[model samples]
Target: MKAQMFDMTRMWGMVTGLVLAIAYFASLYLGFKASEMLPMLVTAIGGFEMFLFSQDVWIKRKRKHG
Candidate 1:
């Protein structure tokens, strides 16, 4: 099947999540404060990605059962 826009979005979300996680850890390892904003931003983006992933699963299940 051809890739859908949602698929592309999920891919990007995965990449973004990885990058953010690495940056957050690297900052700490480098002896820098992760500042207040970084963690919040990561959490917000991670939540959004989780939502997208769940939606994808729900869609697949619906199609399979129906």
Candidate 2:
């Protein structure tokens, strides 16, 4: 069996996306009403990109494994 090769760029992007999402949700739940919504919107777009990239990665991984 071959070990999976991980790409650092994708990993970093994913990590950053997750952090952004966590912070956004945290601020929202913390009653930060004065918080600007622009950052949240940006984070959501970033999250969507990250999700699509990861899904593609998953499909590639499955193909490799099978």
Candidate 3:
């Protein structure tokens, strides 16, 4: 079968990113000190999820071209 352009595997990464983003904002809203690392930790997790989702696209491109 031909490769599909949009795969479901990336959805998990997207969902994870969304959850982390929410948590990041919630942490700040809940009065966690800005000087604390809690918010940043959530931000990092969200960023990593974005990277994972984007990496899936890169891998598909590589497979298609090579």
Q: Give Cα-based local distance difference scores for all models.
A: 0.85, 0.70, 0.67
**Residue 6 shift from truth in candidate 3, angstroms:** 19
Q: Report the error of model 3 at residue 38, Å.
A: 2.0
Choose the strongest candidate by TM-score.
1
- Model 1 residue runs over 4 Å out of place are 1-6
Rank by TM-score, highest first.
1, 3, 2
Better of 1 and 2 by TM-score: 1
Q: All candidates: CA RMSD in angstroms?
A: 2.5, 5.7, 5.4
lDDT of 3 by residue, 1-66 (tens): 233424444455567657766766786899765545655766776677668768989999999999
Question: TM-score of each candidate?
Answer: 0.75, 0.48, 0.48
Top candidate (lDDT): 1
Clashing pairs in 1: none
The residue pairs in collision within model 2 are none
Residue 6 C-alpha lDDT in model 2 = 45
Question: Which residue segments of model 3 deviate by more than 4 Å?
Answer: 1-20, 27-35
Candidate 2: what lDDT?
0.70
Candidate 1 vs candidate 3, lDDT winner: 1
Better of 2 and 3 by lDDT: 2
Q: In terms of lDDT, which candidate is stronger, 1 or 2?
A: 1
Rank by lDDT (best first): 1, 2, 3
lDDT, candidate 3, equals: 0.67
TM-score, model 1 to reference = 0.75
